[model samples]
Target: MRSLAFTAMLLAAPTAAQTAPEAQRPIAASKIVLVGDSTTAVIGGWGPSFCAYHVTSFAACVNLARGGRSSGSYRAEGSWDLALAEMRTPGYKNVWVLIQFGHNDQPGKPGRSTDLATEFPANMARYVDEVRAAGAKPVLLTPLTRRMFKDGKLQNDLEPWAAAIRKVAVEKKVPLLDLNVESSAAVQAMGEAAADRFAQLPPGSAPIGPTATTEIEVRPMAQPKLSFDRTHLGIEGANYFAAMVTRELAAAVPEMRPLLVR
Candidate 1:
């Protein structure tokens, strides 16, 4: 009887050790990961404010966007790899990745741009697969419209890229946020002069040296008129875009409706 009892005790020890951690393990809920470049990155872009002020308490928000990164480069720089790792980690069973790229995908910069024919959609498709493989959903966002205007019309450079995302969304049956279209319309409605307020600049009190300080220029409603960088919003600008994101997500995801701030 004593020998038999000792063996049972040893078996029970392993069960207790395993069961304790299982019982204490915290449950992981749904989460969203935003992947893109500087335009979508937290802080410098609108993504930070979007995650901070827009979404409700129900979902976890993670923005993995980096400055000056294109879709090709984001993956190449291993940012996507880091994002993939995060998705597979414990408590991310209901993960969703939102991908937005393009500004840098144009054929000017080295290592940043892609051919757009095979390279663009191919990268997007690969991202979809990797996200799904990690047991998460992938949502494609058309690049946001740059606030460039010509003759009272919003000039869209990202049209093809946006179209590509839409195409991928249709093919993969994934959710999409047409930020490109929505933002274009939004900026056009605001017009050239009003839109300039969105761009960033150094504070007025900063000293301006003769060398011509890029940081210390008076930010006019359109002062740097030579360049129409009037579209990229500052913190407030990101908040606006973030609101649009919430609205679109609420409509498409519906289940996400309760998680958005009405």
Candidate 2:
């Protein structure tokens, strides 16, 4: 959900250019590579658990997603090049690239915003072409849903963004995983307060995400009950949503399904 408070917090002009990513470390070629913003990055989004649990021993799931990046900025920051480099690694006969964004591309995010109608679809299309050039399959996932609600119904401000991704998926003939639709349905079924359990929360507080781990991190505080994070996830939340993707991938990406854990 795009909120005024968050918008205001991000109004500070971005500083100097980001440093180039660290030197690439060679690892085994993976069957799938995930690319997106914080919502898919390790330690914050679903990538960690998605790779850990959903991937089968026969194949590796490499999550190359990073936080706070949008479709454009990620390429600008050289992360996309790094991702492509990984896709080019030898020893992997086939690979899949999962691309999901839009949370940071929404109306108010300063450094990460993209026009809903034009820039977004164009960016996605470019990614698909480049992934194909690298000899890997590309899968486009609509942005994950934010659990914001009003008047007992969920807000779908992100609908246009999801629509953009879907349009590109169809236009480009790429596989689509409508994570936004799936996640919104999941939240609606759980209700508001119950849905809050999926967010990252203060330590010792009960909820979704990695509370078992997040709550245990030491923060310097006179009192420890004040920290809260609603936009991220822990292991539990990741596992729950990762399962959603796996199920969708099974049916939607029939060929890739054989490589996933059943």
Candidate 3:
């Protein structure tokens, strides 16, 4: 009886020792920072849904994206500094930054448009370098597709910018989400009338206008008014694209899988 009792005690001792350390061990939390334009910003972009629904409590998700921001203006206006500060914050096990631009980077938008051939790629490479310098991993994302159709075919005006971003990702050897390709294909399959449902408001009878040439001059702390447009996202659009981002992110960075919801 004494030998039997001693063996049982030995087994229980190992179990308790194993579990005690695990119980006392701190859970390593990760931080995700989003940097981009209106397509990734709150209210008008997928960032809200991605943070609200896709991430688990084990992650700190910060959406620093803004409306009408391009790669150039985002840094010029001091937004990149804020994002970099977040990346440098201590105590996170891992930090990841997702960068998407291009809608406002196209020509004609003064103070925002970057020369696609030179400035755009250079800016992206700089961002990747800085993110690494701050001890965070950087993931590059192509711009979300604009939900516009011409003669039943989806118009992918952002392709040039997406190509530039892809080239940067390749040259930098960073993870690329290729959101433009995924989103453009998804929107094309949905067709014109179906895709219209993704707009912030119902698309009326008028034709979708050309891309806005001027950057939206919104106050720093005020919410921008949302109107019916192909460029901005509705809740449906947000949820849809947010799910895409979540899935693609999990795949692109497998270590993030445990922190994300499918």
What is the lDDT for 250 in model 1? 77
Q: RMSD, each candidate, Å?
A: 9.7, 21.8, 7.2
Instruction: Write one digit per residue (lDDT tens) for candidate 2, span 1-262.
Output: 5697788777765644544566786554458899999879876688888888889876777888988889988998899999999888888868899999888888777878988788988999999999999999999999888877899998867788999999999999999999989998998888878777776664467533322335556764442222245567756777788888888888888988667874
Candidate 1, residues 28-100, lDDT tens digits: the string is: 4677788998778854577887778877666788889987898899998899989998788775447778899
Which pairs of residues collide in candidate 3? none
Model 1 residue 42 CA deviation (Å) reads 2.0
Candidate 2 stretches greater than 4 Å from native: 1-30, 202-227
For each candidate in turn, the TM-score is: 0.78, 0.79, 0.85
Pairs that collide in candidate 2 are 197-208, 203-215, 209-234, 210-234
Worst 10 residues of 1 by lDDT: 219-228
Against the true structure, whose lDDT is highest?
A: 3
lDDT of all the models against the reference? 0.78, 0.82, 0.93
As a whole number from 0 to 100, the lDDT of residue 187 in candidate 3 is 95
